[model samples]
Target: MHAGTSNFLKAFPIKFAILIATFISLLLVGCSDEAPGAKVPAFKAPDSKAAAKSGAPGGKGPGGPGGRGNKTFAVEGYIAEFHKPSGSFQTMATLEALNRVELSAAANGRLVNLYAKDGASVQKGSLLAKIDDSELKAQLKQAESSLHLAQQKMERTKGLVEKNAATTTDMEAAEASLKSAEASVELIKAQIAKTEVRAPFSGKLGFVNVSVGAWVTTGTSIATLSEVTKLKAKFALPQRYATTLKVGNPITLIDEERAIQKVGKVTALDATISESSRTRQIMVTVDNSKGELIAGGYAKVSVELQSGRTQTIPVPAEALTLDKDGAYIFVVQDGKASMRRVETGLRTPIAVDVISGLNEGDTVITSGLISIRQGSSVRIREIRNNTDYEVD
Candidate 1:
């Protein structure tokens, strides 16, 4: 029995060596069986640790035929537009009346008639008030009588000179006296006309400084007149937008404090940038026939930047992702996510115009962007037709 045990021990080592040789041969044959450059289909393998805990193999067969990946990604997409036409920008603005004036007394006199009331509408050249002209009118009457007497003396002198009754020098002196009297009459008439005050233009009247029977002097401010039929808004922006600002461009007036809104057009632009603000001033004209807007009021001006280009590539603003490198986006191509860097141009509230790196018809992932890397295989479970705005 001792001799049989030694022989068995020796044979056991030889059998073990044979088993090792056979395993190496199988491994070599298995490696050579696959042809070079041939692809092996991939499939989700079970977890090795779980398989070992359950005492099962981790290997699994390839996915079902059709060359489609098994991993599915639920996501929403936005199709970029290549022909977006417009964009919007907003800025602070100041409202001013198209025409405003402070009516002042042109001459010193007692106010006899007050024709204009507070907040009253008056037409151009309309009567507003009249000052007492009693003294001036009396002087005008005396001047007219003196001028008539001077004219009679000049006529009598001319006839006497023709008949040799008077000299030519006396006739010339009479004519000069007649001219002096005529000048006095015109001066008094002009002074009397100044007593009647009139509106300079059509507008609404403000508070009056004097009432009837009150004494007023020249240069005394009487009231304010504003042409509220139309209004003008002035706003400023960076000098870079000088070329983009055009005559007749659209402008929207928004007064959030009073909840008022109106539309207007850019009437004029400053010739150069303002040195103090380093900005370009633009003027917008709006119709205020309804008297809704007040002069010297506050509001916001929204300017639409059309950039003169009718076509632009637009993508959802939220779809854009920013990094230190620059702006980038994830696009789905052939059921896979591809990350691409892009350059942006004009941006609106809803979307951004892509200047480069993306083309029309490129599907951009607007939703379900987390955890997806470049070249990630994805199965589209839901295709959203909304390509204009963000999902949320």
Candidate 2:
């Protein structure tokens, strides 16, 4: 019985150990099934470190992307050669008029006749319009009759006074009567002449403001006449150029496109600068027999400053950019854009002169500049079969 009891105790201890092992294995299998997959989340590692640093009381890192630097900016520019003046700047052509006048009536009267129309050629002393003069002619006739009678009496009194047949006072009265009648006739004739309006100078007439039977007052404009056969353009120049400009100086007037249409000579220059504008007036005359030029047209004037020859670098105006440091451009080097600051001189609508900060044979990025910043990588596309570097 002691042996059997010892055997039962040994079997019991073995069974208890086996049950504890099986329970632990099942618990581990259940826990493993409940846990998540092995794939790690993106950026979680770095984010965890960032959160820890931020939560720290005295962290060194800035809050939420504030430590990032300036954003990259893209821009475009073009390559151009710098130019220095060779002889002188080209002359600019401008339109101007020398003399302008408005024709008006001298006396108040109804317009009886109009002989001239707009754009009509007229000569000096040519009759333009006529006012009613019937009353003036009747007064002239009466004065003439009185003068005839007065002269006859004066002749008789002179002979009588010489022959001692008339008193001295009577002779004097005859003389005064004759003079008064003659003066009255002349005054009436003068009024009659005023009725006929004549041209003061030979020129083409402008529009006539008054029509026949229209009552016009003194100093009312009748028409405008101008001599456009020869035109004069007057412009103001800075006082500094006053000394250089003189009468008879040859000037080439340039149209807006820098085309030289006419050559003119300086006719006059004001002696002093105007106090308000600090500019002196200059007058230039050009032959316009063809009537191609009209009055009051704008022109550009180019004057030769110095007689020295220098290389000039001309670039298109669109290739220029401006920043806080004046003007600049972008130059592409080894697939990277380099910011280059430039100095600009004369500027035209199409082109500008570069004074400094660029060299010949350098390629400049004229397009795609708005997408590039300094030291940015770029992909250059070749302009297929396009020789001209024109900006759209």
lDDT, candidate 1, 1-392, per-residue tens: 99999999989988999999999988876788577556788998768555544435332322222322344676777776566444766888999999999888889999989998998999999888899899999999999999999999999999999999999899989999999999999999999888888888899998987788888999877789999999999999665455677899888999898899999999999898988877898999999999888889888988776675546577778788899999999989998889989998766667777879997888888876775667666656555554444211
Deviation in Å, model 1, residue 245 alpha carbon: 2.5
How many clashes in candidate 2?
24
Model 1 ranges with Cα > 4 A deviation: 1-86, 157-168, 309-392
Q: What is the TM-score of each predicted model, taking all chains together?
A: 0.55, 0.53
| Candidate 2 lDDT, 269-385, residue by residue in tens | 887899997668788888877776776676666555454333445666666788777998777777677777888655556765666877875667767677566666655554221
Q: Whole-model lDDT, candidate 1?
A: 0.81
Residue 375 C-alpha lDDT in model 2: 63
State the weakest 10-residue window (summed lDDT) of model 1: 59-68
